[model samples]
Target: MKLKKIFLITVAVLSVFYTIGCWDMVDIDKRFFVGNIGVDRAEDGEQMLVTFTFPIVRKIAGGQGGGQGGGGGSTIVVISTVTDSIHAAARQAAMRLSRRLFFEHTRVILIGEELARDGIEEVVNFLERNTEINRRGRVIVVRGKAKDALTIKNEIEVLLALYIANIFENRDICARFIETDVDEFMKQVHSMNGNVLLPRLTPGKTDVKIGGAAVIKKYKLVGWLEENETLGANFVLGEISGADIMIDIPGYKYPVVFTVTHNKAAMELLEAGDYPKFRVKLEVKGEIVETPEQIQLAPEMLKIIEKMLEDRINHMVLASIRKLQEEYQVDLLGFGEYLSKYKPDVWEEYKKDWENIFPDAEINVETKVKIRGIGASK
Candidate 1:
């Protein structure tokens, strides 16, 4: 009887902890899930403007009958507030919102060109410190206002953030745009020099186009690169997985398309001294994707196609390098990184004045292409 009384007391004591209830519990219906965040400079020119986009769960959720005709508005709500900091802006936005703002589902982060040109230190810090945000969240610089990109009416994906995020899945297929997420951007920012390229977003009449790339030097946007230049940059970076080259056949009155099947790049530091000389060799293998009806799939014809592809690839890659060497005077081609790893002595000697020295560096490019096969033919 004495032992039974002690056992009953132990069970009664453990029940109290579970019965206390959750101190941090909030009702699910009282929270909003943020899908995208946009940062821009305020018109007043003294404060930062932050926009938060969240979907109306009931309207977006499948099997729910909600639309403009049903006395409802757009499926997403965008709210903007001007403040000195991101946290402050969030707090200000919460004032008029009936539900608490949550950011665990944020997929895209858009920065206005104006704000990107200024600098993204504070924005980077906020992303780093926010535990709720995923590191895979994409980062883009809008050509104009980031808020406008967030406000776009996307028919493909109900949420604009998801639509923008889905575009990155084609990185391998195009290679014309760099896939930069929060983690990748941060890694580049912490490199030997904070020089990187981020994809540019432009809003159109009926859709948003994601192409090109914004050149960032020392964490500030300096300029932009066109789609061809971006593709050339990708070639030098060895980031090209799949892309096409058009070859104009002589006397065929039509162009033949070559789809890249394999690619490799090699860099040789021929002479390491004041104003070093480097040679880049790019090798590519492709298959004829499109050809004229009368064209014969002969070895000689294939050889001609290969030669043409070589010249075109060489021109494309060299143009990007020259632009970096002459116009931007920035090194996004990993020349500095190559020297730092392979020849630390040279990097140490020129690291201080690399900005000035890179332009003077002699670079030579050589391209070789092989035609592997002709589609549905020899």
Candidate 2:
């Protein structure tokens, strides 16, 4: 009888397990996966113009619908809607899309220049609150219309989002563009006193260029950093992985290119008085990539080359700091953070007015370069 009871219990458990069904499961074929999202200012000046790019999975999987439409079978489709909030914009887009919209696959988020300048607090809040959106989604500010970037004809990647997303893969090679994600930006906005640097993307004919950066001060876009300026900021932040430096050789009329192999920067608080002073020292190691004519790879010659590279780096670093001090007056270089961490007493006095005091602070840059190798002896 006990054996019979055990057999009956086993059968009942098996029946319960087999009877369960996917009550809340949604089919993959019934959803539109968003690859990219663009946010801009609406024509009404009050609402937001949101753009969504959805990739056609059928064409991507080499099934059908390859170049069948008027535009010759595009890989992705872009749709725009005007709404007061991101959620509202998503709902508005759903009215036209044949399938349910999904954001779990989103790779990039582009913000229009005007909208970024006005402020990105609302957009930041939306991304932070949305659980469906991936935290790794890239965040960038487009120089012009964000929608323009979304509509670009990308021949490299099937989706423009992937094209933009792949640019950061080579960040270690140049360090001109920063990779800012949704979570990273939100953390900076909340912890950095609303100061952050977001990568800048400019759309071109049939392509898009991701370089430089947009400077955000107090949660508003104040200005932009060119590629060189961006590199300078990276130097101060000690984020430089590799970069190329071109300097005019002393006697030669042509410029010699030095490819940085290693780079580091150190900050020293010289004084913590009413007018704090700081000194930044940058150490760089590079290899000669290109040189004009027959150049001697002697120690003395390397010294001259090293000095020239040092001066050039000093100028670039100063130019970046000048823009921050005079043009934007924003400390996006972590000068305030440094003071707060090392010299807390000094920071306490200037914490209330760091923005104003930062402009008056004395900061200096010093660079040292070592030429390790000259490619191939003649």
Candidate 1: residue 10 Cα off by (Å): 9.1
Q: Tell me the TM-score of model 1.
A: 0.91
Top candidate when judged by lDDT against the true structure: 2
Residue-wise lDDT of candidate 1 within 1-378, one digit each (tens)? 999999998888767655765565567788888888999999997688999999888776642543433345688899999998887887899998999888878899998999988997788888888887889999898999998888776677777788899998988777788788999888887884568888999988658988888988887889998888898888778777788888887778779998887778888788977898999888887788899778878988788888888889889988989998898999988898899998898889889999999998999888889888788965
TM-score of each: 0.91, 0.92
Report each candidate's C-alpha RMSD, comma-separated, in the order given: 3.0, 3.2
Query: Can you tell me which runs of candidate 2 are displaced by over 4 Å?
Result: 1-24, 63-72
lDDT of 1 at 316: 90
lDDT of 2: 0.87
- Give every collision pair in model 1: none
lDDT of 2 by residue, 1-378 (tens): 999999999999887767764554569999999988999999887789999999888777663444443354787989999998888998999899889889999999999999998999988888999999999999999999999998887788776788889888888788887777888888888878788999999999899999999999988999899999998888888877778889886678878998887888888889877777989999888799888876767788888888889999999999999899999999888888888898888889989988888988899999988888898973
